[model samples]
Target: MTVTEKDRDILARTLWGEARGEGLAGQIAVAWAIRNRVDDGKLKSWWGEGYSGVCQAPYQFSCWNKNDPNYAYLSGAMAIPFRELAQCRGVADQVTDGRVPDPTGGATHYYAIAMPKAPAWAAKARQTLKLGGHVFFKGVP
Candidate 1:
């Protein structure tokens, strides 16, 4: 897929919102999850068309949700930290260009360990990786 600047920017913002505190490895894992969705032929329609579409798909990434706290910064209502966003941008570029390896082992789903309770879907999902504050999974039913 030809990733547009908007795609890269949204992907970077997603990484910043979702995994900025988790550092480079965590951000990479999150990026791979998005990429997995982008590359999955089975659920192409479900995941939206490409990077931008997938990231902005309704209720997919919470950072894009209108009520989400991160939405303010992601939508430009607030400002993001320059250094952190820059790092996320670098990770986004690498992952989208296929330079970074799939650290989540093809995971298409993940949730932070900080959540009060795991999401219901996680119980039916096969766990693929556990890194930083998030648990990665695949084959979710």
Candidate 2:
């Protein structure tokens, strides 16, 4: 399906395992996405199998830097939309060092995921990976 018609959904698949810690948050954070073939209990079935949880809030992402020597040089070589990059940054935020790029490639917009108990970043990465993209997780960040 085209990115525009994705009807996208985000799921936070805790990288460290957010199994209820302190007042909240636990060991890890992750996100995931699932669409088109639903079996009613699909989400619940995959909750632990692959998905850690879901992100029920807005996320931030960018694509340029004005202070850097490469000012106007798309942040991290990202020239995609804030969301397209957001899907990448969400995961990169916790996976890579300084993955959060500057917001300048496009208009900044926020969208909500259906999952509240999960990290939104992880969920977005999963969706992009499913589309044949490579997402490397950060080590011991």
Candidate 3:
């Protein structure tokens, strides 16, 4: 549970990529989902090793995908807006440091409400929260 700077950076970038438009609360929820994955003892293998591992794991968060529009910014190939990234970094630090309560209610998965249709997995999972433009869920099958 020792979060390194790499972990913080990756988590911050992930928040920036995934939920920047949703603002601080939304970003915090997303961060908790990643943290939940990191802290899940039962599914550790599936989620990868830690914050960086889980964020960069293949096909989990679409922003990490090479073809995604956010990839360049998230990967540092393109510069992210300073104020936005700083806000995301603050959320990342608070979430990773256990300073913020999980608004996602132990959610390990989420999808933008703007999607044409919810992901198939969402049907099997328990919905936790609906905040900003996303829906949070846990116990995804």
Candidate 4:
């Protein structure tokens, strides 16, 4: 697969119904799981940072697990890539660095996004932004 920017955009549009901001963020989070997190690599950081920027937190996927409440709430939603609906609802610790079996019998990649901004993170980002923080997000294919 080429996995070009255009491909990402189309995939986002197809999945999310619209095609930018939180909508694109939702799909890109899924793609990030498939592209960078499904395994592990320098590319992982790219997706992690991208997810964090859009959703407004310093999201890191490795920390998510089934034991956590945040993970439980986010799993079903991220698995299907919803819009800003996943935004700012707590530590939305969605994962984008693993795979799960498909109902049809296949393993699919995963990615995560966090919501409601965990206290530590929200505080830190708030402070930084207060001091002038610059944020950026990747464009989908």
lDDT of 2 by residue, 25-137 (tens): 11112222221112124444332221112222211111112443322323234333454334433442332222333221111112223235544444443222111111212
**lDDT values, one for every candidate:** 0.94, 0.24, 0.94, 0.30
Q: Candidate 3, residue 90: CA error in Å?
A: 0.4
lDDT (10s digit) by residue, model 1, range 40-113: 98998888988999999998999999999999999988999999899999999999999979989889999999
Q: Which residue pairs collide, candidate 3?
A: none
Error of 4 at 133 (Å): 13
- Candidate 2 Cα deviation (angstroms), residue 2: 37
Q: Is candidate 2 or candidate 3 better by lDDT?
A: 3
Per-model TM-score versus the true fold: 0.97, 0.17, 0.98, 0.22
Candidate 4 residues lying further than 4 Å off, grouped into runs, are 1-21, 37-59, 62-69, 75-141
Poorly placed runs, candidate 3 (over 4 Å): none
Displacement of the residue 62 alpha carbon in candidate 2, Å:
20
- What's the lDDT of the predicted structure labeled candidate 4? 0.30
Q: Can you write out model 4's per-residue Cα lDDT over 90-136, one digit (the tens) per residue?
A: 11222232232212111123212233333333322221111011121
Candidate 3 TM-score, true structure as reference: 0.98
